[model samples]
Target: MRKKRRYIIVMATCILCFFGIIYFIVPKILFYTQMYDNRINVAIKNATDIHDLLEEAIHCIEKRQYYSAIKLYQKVVQDYPYHKKTEGAQHAIGSCYEWAGNYKKAKEAYNIFMKKYPDSKLAEICRQHVVELDNPIYRKVNDAMVDKPEQLDKIIKKCQKIVNNSSGQKKTDAMLKMGECYFLKKEYLMAIEIYQEIISNYPDYSRIREVEQMIGVCQGLLGNYGKR
Candidate 1:
C-alpha cells in the first residue's frame, strides 16, 4: 500500500509537471496551488478536438476510468475552459481523487471548482463536501483549526466519535489521537489514561512505539518521571 501511494505521488507529480504545474506537500500545513494563467493554448487545437476530448472524457468517467478522465479534464482546463462541460470536468476531477482515496487532494480539487465557478449551482454542494472532508476525526485534534477552548471541545467530541465508532487500526489511530487532543489541552491525566488504554488494547499494533513515547511524555508533563 505504501509503495502504491508513493508511485501515485510520483505519477501525479510527473503529470502536473508535464503541463507546467507543481504539487508540493508540507507535513504540517494545508496548501494547494496550480497556475494556468497566460499559458492556456487553445490556438493549437481546433474547436472540434476540444469537443471530442470532452465527450471522450465523459465516457471514460462513466466507465470508471477516472485517471484517464482526469488527464482529459486537465487538457480541457489547460486548453479550453470555454468548453461547455468545463465545470463538470472540474467536479469530476475532484470526484476522481475522492474515489482514488485522497480526500485532501479531492478537497483541493473541489476548492479549485469553488474558486473558478463560485456562482455555479454546484458551488454550495462542493463547499459542503469540503466541510465533510475537514471533519477532524480523520486526522488528530491537534490538526484542527482550534483557536479557542470551545473549539477544542468540539474537536474532542469529534475525535471521541472515532474512538467509539471505529475498530481495528482506524480505532487505534483515533484512540491515540484522543490522547493527543487531551495532551494539547494540558489535561495530562486524561491523556495518560487514554494512552494507557491504547497500550493495553493494542499491544501488537504498528504504532505502539509512538504510543509509548506519548505515554512517557504525558507522565513527564505530570511530574511523574521518578515513578517510572
Candidate 2:
C-alpha cells in the first residue's frame, strides 16, 4: 500500500510538470516562430488600400524592420501600380535600404524609380542620391565622419564648397551635411541656421520634413542648454 501511494504521488507530480512545460515553454516557442510572419500577414490583410499599406510600411521602418517594410512597399508597387502614391512607396523602399546601410541596393532601387517615374518630383532627389552614394566625400560624411567628430570641421568645409559651386539638388544636400556637422559640434544655433537656409532656398526639397524636424530638435537642445 505504501509503495503504491508513493508511485501515485510521483506520477501526479510528473504529469503536472509536463503540463506546466507545455503551457509556458511551448507557447513561447510558437510565439517566436510566428512573430514576424504572423504580424506581417495580419498587417497586409488589414490594409485596404495603398495608403494603408504605405502607413504600415512607415511604421515598420520606425521599428527598424526594413525587410518587412520592403515587402509592404513592394505590395503597393505590385498591386496598385497606377495609384498616385505608388511612386512614393517605391521611393520609400530605396530610402529603407539606404537607412539600413545597404547603399548598393538603395542605389539600384533609386535608379529603377527614376527610370519608371522619369518626370516625378522625386526624380531629381533620386539623381542626387545616386550621385552621393557614388561620391567618396558623401560616403565619408555618412559612414564615418559623424562617428568621428574631429573630422566634422573638415567635412563642413567640403560641404560649404559644394554648396557654393552647386545649385538646386546638390546645394540642398550639401547644406544638410553642413547642418549635421554643426549639430555634432554642439553648435545648435549654427545647425538651425544652416537648416533654415535649406528651407528658404529649397522649399520643394524632398527632405524638407526631415530638415524641419532637425530644426525642432535643435531648438529643444537650445532650451535644455538654457536650463543647464
Candidate 3:
C-alpha cells in the first residue's frame, strides 16, 4: 500500500510539471502575438499623421519657407522610414535641396527617389528637373540672370557634349539649347541648322512648333529672305 501511494505521488508530480511547462510557454507565445498585433494597429493609426505632415510641408513650401518645409519632411523620412509616405518625403528632400542651392545633392536625392520608387508620380517630376539641370541654355540663362554670364561658353560646351552623348528627347532638348546659345551670340546660321534639326528629328516634342518658328526667324536673319 505504501508502494502504491509512492507510485501515485510520482504520477501526480509529473502531471504538475507538464502543466507548469504548458502554462509558461502558452502565455509567452500569446504575449508576443498580442504585441505584434498592437504594433500593426499603431502603424495604421499613425499613417494619416504622416499625410498631415506632408500637407503642412506643402503649405510651408508655397509660402516660400523652404527650410521649414525641409525640416518637417526630414522628420517624416526619419521618423517613419517604414511608412508609405517615405517616397514623398524623399522627393521633398530633393526639392528642398534644389531650393537650398544644392543642385548636386538635389540630383543625388532625386536619383535615389527614382531608383526606389520608379513608378511614383513624383519620380516623373524629378526626371524633368534632371533634364532641366542638364540643359546648357537653361543653366546659362540662370547664370546670366544671376550675374555669371562668364559661364555662358562653358554652359554651351556642356550642351554640345550632351547632344553628342544622348538621344531622343534629351538630345533634342540639348540641340534646341545649343541653337538658342548661338542665337544669343548672334551666330544666326549655326542657330538655324540646330533649330532645323529639331524640326526634323524631334517633331513629336511639344516644343516643335516653337522650334519651327525659331527656324523661320533664323532663316530670315541669315538673309534667306523667303516667305514661308
Candidate 4:
C-alpha cells in the first residue's frame, strides 16, 4: 500500500509538470509565431501600397495629368519614406516639374533628388538634368539656375523676396514657388503651411486649382493625408 501510494504521487507530479509546460511554453511558442506572421503581413501590405501608388503615378503621367501624378507620387514618398519605390517616385516629381515648363522649380527638384540620394543610380542622371537646366543656353530661355545643395537658403531667399514684393497673380505664383522651394528642401510641414496659406488668401487666384493640388501633395508628403 505504501509503494502504491508513492507511485500515485509521482504520477500526479509528472502530470502537473506536463500541464505547466503547456500553460507556459506552448502559449509562448504560439505567441511568437503569430507575432512573426503579423510582421510579415505588415511588410506585404507596405509593398503592395507602394507598388499601387507608383503604378497610379505612372498612369497619371501617361495621361498627362501631371498634377494628379505628382499628388500620387508624393503619397508614395510620405507613406513609405525609405521604401524601395520612394527613389523612383522622387525622380518622377523632378521630371514632372520640367515637363510642366517650371524650369527653376525643375532644377530645385532635380538638385534635391540628387542630394537626398547621392548614392543612388539616379544621382548621375539628376546631376545631368541640373547641369542642362543651369546651362547658359537654357538659362537664356527660362532664366533658371540650378540651386545646389549648398544654395537652398539662397533659393528660398529669392522666392521670399518675390513673395514680399509681388502683387496680384504674380504674388500668388510667388507664394506657390516659395512653397515649392520648401518642398524641395524636404521641409514638408513648412511647404504644407505655405500651400494652405495660398488656398486661404488667394481664393480668386487663377491657379487656385494648382495651388490646392500642391497643398494636397505637400500634406501627403508630410503624412497628413487625413487632412488631405
Query: In terms of lDDT, which candidate is strongest?
Result: 2
lDDT of 2 at 201: 78
lDDT per residue as tens, model 1, 1-228? 999999999999988876553234442223311221111223224336665665555445444455666777787788777876577667768766654556788899999999999987667657866886687653343335223445666766877898789889888877766776676677878988888888898887666655665565456456554132
Point out the worst 10-residue segment of candidate 4 by lDDT. Answer: 140-149
Clash pairs, model 2 backbone: none
lDDT of 2 by residue, 135-202 (tens): 87667666655447688888899889998898987889789888977876778889999899888878
Cα lDDT tens digits for candidate 3, 1-228: 999999999999999999998999889988976775464444444647776566556555444455666767777887788887577578768766665556787788889888988976667767877786678755556546223545557768988999889888888877877776675565778888888778777768665644665564456455453322
Spell out the clash pairs found in candidate 4.
none
- Which lDDT value does model 1 have at 79? 71
| C-alpha lDDT of all candidate models, in order | 0.65, 0.78, 0.68, 0.68
Summing lDDT over every window of 10 consecutive residues in candidate 1, give the lowest-scoring window. Answer: 32-41
Q: What TM-score would you give candidate 3 relative to the actual structure?
A: 0.38
> In candidate 1, residue 172 scores what lDDT?
82
Cα-based lDDT at residue 43, candidate 1: 22
Residue 110, candidate 1: how far off, in angstroms? 0.6
Expressed as tens digits, the lDDT of each residue in 1-228 for candidate 4 is 999999999999999999999999999999976775464444445656776675555545444456566667777778888887587678778768775667777788878888889987667767767887777764442323233444656766877888898788778766776776666666778888888888788877665645565565556555554254
Ranking by TM-score: 2, 4, 1, 3
> Candidate 4: misplaced stretches above 4 Å?
1-51, 54-147
